[model samples]
Target: MNENKKTLGELLNASYSAFGYAIGFSCLVNLLMLTAPIYMLQVFDRVLPSQSSDTLVYLTIIAILAIIVYGILDIARAQVLTRVSWWIDNKLSPIALAKSLDHTLLGGSYAAQSLADITTLRQFLSSPSIYAFFDAPWIIIFLIVIFLLSFPLGIIATLGAIVLLSLAILNEKVSRKPLEQANTLHMNNQESISNSIRQAECIQAMGMMSPIVSKWLHNNEAVLAMQCTASDRSGIVLSFSKSIRLILQILILGVGAYYVINGELTSGAMLAASIIMGRALAPAEQAIGAWKQAINALQAYRRLQHYLSQPETRPPEILLPKPQGRIDVNNLLYIPAGAKKPVIQGVQFTLMPGESLGIIGPSGSGKSTLARLLVGIWPPTNGTVRLDGANIYTWNRQDIGNHVGYLPQDTLLFKGSVKENIARMDKIEDAKIISAAQFVGVHDMILHLSHGYDTDTSRYHLSGGQAQRIALARAFYGSPALVVLDEPESNLDQEGLAALELIYKNAQKSGITIIVVSQRPMLMKHCNKVLVMRDGHMERFGLYAEIIR
Candidate 1:
């Protein structure tokens, strides 16, 4: 297990210092924003009336310098946010991908959604919607300046702020449900499409394309409707907020004029007040406009939190000697995560090194499930599986991975060179890969490939038998002490079956413990012990001759 696995919140919390720097930059940028209005004030009150070119030139140079500094700080603020986004992505993407793989093994759907959530958060951090928040707190600074210029004008700006803030709240209230619903539906649709693509052969052969497309469109239509509802409502609120800000600007200027008429305010102050009022209301207006994005990011963060909440409890690896294939099971029972009944129950068995066990059963007899438990892919609901006197489930897999070989019922080969696949993606020498291939009788078949041992599985298509053989070779790659093969001969011809028998002979000679889940006569003949399963129960266990009799 990775000791550095962090929950999403912790990862985000770790980046708080980066965000603090961004905020500091934003602070400087916002303070520099005062340069524009103040320049207008000085030009109106001092330069114009002084009728002196020296004063005008000096003010212009000062204003230009201030604006230049403001621009640099603003760019720096955005750069900080960008780096923070990358930093968080660098830390969290690997964890999300690892967790997604774990989730897939646990039969979870939409495993890629965790990665997508990280992407959403990364984009949100780099987006302007976030900067609106960083600048929001400075709204009061502009408001207080407005008050100093004219009290009545300040009151109007404050009212405008209240109205726009109210609209922001309204935007959230009305749009949250639809946005959340739309996101859920969208994710489900993506999962369905991805699954359908993987099974395209079956779907196309059975003429399921039309119905599948229609159902997909129906789901998409529902998602679109929800998104439209949210967007329409958000648009209305955003438009309203903008209109209010505009009206506030005009009202500030009008009230400032009235005060100027009474000698309570100067003309320079009147124009400055209008500009300041707009500045005060800008953040609220921008927030209302980006409210939908903000909501999406919040929801994405929450989803990431939920998925990453699982603790990595795999114990630290201890320097233990390699397992020698001795096996034990006591009252082993397993029920899947959300199931009412156990898939396998009250089953117990043991095998010594160099022994072989054959598990035979009907279609729904849980043979495959048992094989998974034996290999420690799934933890038992009750009891334990011990290999060489250590709990197989608790053993650090990395420490003993080479000693345990598993060939799942549904064989899958990764998109890599033939040698890489045989070596389990480990950086091993060609001699070892050739040995595994030769041991499993796949060496000749692999040499016949276009690139021999270097063929990429993705580019060079293979028949079902070919793929299964490659997976078999992988299982035997390291000369594992315990090799569990589920239906190993299902896709093999007579030649392949003969090869499998030869491998079994090789295993016997090498002192490897073997478990085969099959009723195929060619495979069953090689098993000294047979366990018969029916509806997840061990109905018979003894010598092969007695079980067959």
Candidate 2:
């Protein structure tokens, strides 16, 4: 698993050759930028003085050709960056998605931010903003050319470059904090809105929408204020830099005119020197213009680096035989990441092959947490949960996935056909889907839908009871050896309850071990053993009749 861990920095390092090509192209583009000034010099100094139309025409032709080549090279540079951006996205998106899922499963928020960061990074990579930095270093070439034209002009141009560079630095320092703050607030606001949307039915039914909207508006105002602060600061710097560049260009023209009058520089040289000075300072001004994007991209890059640096959570792939129905929990404890108290602690139990156990507990007594542990969804902080004598959390999912079934409390049905969801999103034989559906007695219910087994879950809305039945079929898919069902009967009706009993009988007949987190009497009658829990500790564990007596 470690061998598969790849970082954004490492991926960029691998693309160094592509960047090198872009830099090489930038060099040629910057060199070709001198075409206009050189052409001006030749036309004004040599062509006019010599009174030669041929010389002017030939100069024009050469300048046009140089500009064409410069345009082609510039396009090539952008193309290279675009391709590199795609390559990085292709490699890092899956890793980002996996990490995002792991982070969410571990009870963290901001899962969407990882993908958003990738978009920001990719946009900056293929944007004109990045090219500004590449073009920045070549300003020295323009300054040198200015010096060769006139020493005084060269000094002035150099000072102008230094001043613009300072403003660019100042822009970064001033606007970075507010921009970063605004970005953080924006992400929070997005998460808030997403949560509200997900619970829109509840909010509307309970008259909670007004309060939720008010709170959202309040948070959004803060985000806007921070963004305004950043923009005002950047605007000031950018505007000042633009003004300074214009003033310098005018100053150069005035100085060149004076020098030309004094015969210290020729007319062509004076004109060329002013143009070169403007070219020398253009990069710094452009950098100021795009400073905000640069800072955002830098922040995104850093976040991705940290996100990718996390240790791989997936177990290494190994060929292991299918697990029997045995489970062993040895002194297991689990404390959430930022919590002081454990959700489930000192939990120890064992179930022999094909034995069914029912977990009973109050609302906050960690029954769901224990069910999660049994299915390897959450790792224990201390001790281990072993299936077939191997730690369940460390068992390679690819090897053990087919042998286990889990129905989470939420009972989510992914967007797919009824048959596809029953098959756990795997495209498999229709016989397996039908058999799994039949095991849970949902096969007839599925056929009554608009498209029978092929109905799209996204477009068709199932009633709560119907969805639960379908989810039950999914849990019973493939005749798994171990099945953990959390609050499985919450949405069931009388018929559904009868189906649940049939499922238990079918599971027992097939020798599948069941761990159900429920307290209902109907479900309890089918369990051989019952484990009672309260306050993160086990209250009792024995045969169902023994516990009841």
Give the candidate number with the greatest lDDT.
2
Residue range 350-459, candidate 2, lDDT tens digits: 99878999999788999999999898888788989888888888788755668899888998799888888898888667888899999998988999999999999889
TM-scores of all models?
A: 0.94, 0.95
By summed lDDT, the worst window of 10 consecutive residues in model 2 runs over: 1-10
- Best-fitting candidate, measured by TM-score? 2
Off by over 4 Å in 2: 1-9, 313-317
lDDT of 1 at 494: 83
Q: On a 0 to 1 TM-score scale, where does candidate 2 land against the true structure?
A: 0.95
Count of clashes in candidate 1: 0
Candidate 1, residue 507: the lDDT equals: 87
